[model samples]
Target: MRKVSRDRGYHHGDLRASLITASFELLAEVGLRRFSVAAVARRLGVSSAAPYRHFPGRDHLLSAVSAAAAHDLRSAIVAAADRAGADPSSRLASVAEAYFRYVVRTGAGFHVIYAAELYAVPDEARREQTRALMATLLELASAVGVPSHRQAVALVEAIVAVAHGYTTLFAEGFFAQGALTVDATAARAVAAAEALIRAAGDR
Candidate 1:
């Protein structure tokens, strides 16, 4: 896509959307340590000052980016859960697998969204996105006869923790020495989630 030049005078109809798309690309390419408004502007082919027109500062831009990422992750989890039939174990497995796939697809940007420093709880939309993700997991746990709300919550926490840890390790190449196919790796995460849910039911 032809990026707007600094001299182009913002002819595009949606400058904010353009900046966000550029920001995601730049972050994925360089990661959080080197992220800056200037890099985003460069990706958009605009002057360094161009992003400030929409974002005020890097934090605001990052907040928006992180919020978008969180929303996408929630959607993926919900969709996968819905598609995995009525079995709670299958739903949990599908959601866990979806999460791992998302990590593989988004990597550093995925970490950025989940980072508490960037995605503050004060952001209502992001907060709701997080709640929705938990609600889906909790619903699945309840379906599996986890016995009580508190137990279901604990089961969900374990599921998310294990899935996140696996994704982080996998993305960082901790498992690079293993000849693991994406399906096999996702299966491992799914199995962990199922085991946690089943153990909760047993207990």
Candidate 2:
């Protein structure tokens, strides 16, 4: 990723996309609470007031940042599933691993996307990304022999819930800092997701 010169003006190029990119990095660096439109503008070498033209306010800008996270998460899960071999349950479980790794790699983005209430009232574009991820999850769930849409949805939610639990514990250092490495924690999440998927089949 090219680091944009902070000395450049907002009108130099595609400011809208630039702002989103900068905002995502800022979210990763600072956090949701400290994130502001002005901070992102400063990172991009734009006037604090300049970002208002593209983003109505901080919430709108954060919406774009979370949407970028969705894009990253969706791609990561799909790639992980592809590499998990022919076993449907394994492939589905790998998605959970991808999520665990994603949280570890970008904690702030995860918190902003999930813990920040973004899902409660997602913008239309964000909703589209959520649907796309749901579609991917459903596809993997179907592969696990999940028969009904209702069951598939439940299974997806359960896997994510369990992954969230594990990630929250490990990433936040609830366990002693050295007790569980990121990959070790991710492996546990994968096992939990697999167990959930297998249990779904038994039900």
Candidate 3:
């Protein structure tokens, strides 16, 4: 599935969509810092100037990619939480697990969706998508009980931080140095997230 998404060649049809798909591969290959519209065009066998017809600049292209990534992330979180059944704690833990798993499985996904450079101003659509995703975590965190409303926000933050932190470590080869697997890391994220949620109730 991952291979299919990354390696899809642009035989015909919408060239704009093809550019975005090619950008995904370029991003995963070289990351955001070095990503280029020219490179994506080359990947699609289009002229270096081809992507400019759809996207005015690299930032515009990246915004489109980030928006798409935000939608994908939201879907993954909702599906994982729903599958966890009626347990509030399980649902929240599953959210963290799903997020961690997604970042590891899809290269440049987390970074692309939450890029610091782009969010300085933020696009309305992207912001709304992210807000919806965070709202789910906030709802689940509230269900577990918080000493105060502010603490509920903190609970959600802690879970997201832990999941992203673990994923970043895994990406940096911190887990590969040992006998660790993606599933194992995701479980660890779940445990850490659960522990934090439980502790939040104690406070």
Best-fitting candidate, scored by TM-score: 3
Q: How close is every model to the real structure, measured as TM-score?
A: 0.80, 0.82, 0.86
* Per-residue accuracy of model 2 over 13-110 as CA lDDT, tens digit each: 58988888777667656666788899888887778898888778887887876777777788888999989999999999998899888766665334
Rank candidates by lDDT, best first. Answer: 2, 3, 1
Runs off by more than 4 Å, candidate 3: 1-8, 108-110, 120-122
Screening candidate 2 with a backbone cut-off below 3 angstroms (N, C-alpha, C), the clashing residue pairs are none
* Candidate 1 ranges with C-alpha deviation above 4 Å: 1-11, 108-111, 118-122
Per-residue accuracy of model 1 over 1-203 as CA lDDT, tens digit each: 12445453454668787777676666655667788888888776778997888887887887777777777777788788888988877887676788787766654334577665654435676667656766766787788876689987777777777877887777667878996777888889998888776677667
lDDT value, candidate 1, whole model: 0.73
Clash tally, candidates in order: 0, 0, 0
Q: What is the Cα-based lDDT of residue 153 in candidate 2?
A: 86
Better model by TM-score, 1 or 3? 3
As a TM-score, model 2 comes out at 0.82
**Stronger candidate by TM-score (2 vs 3):** 3
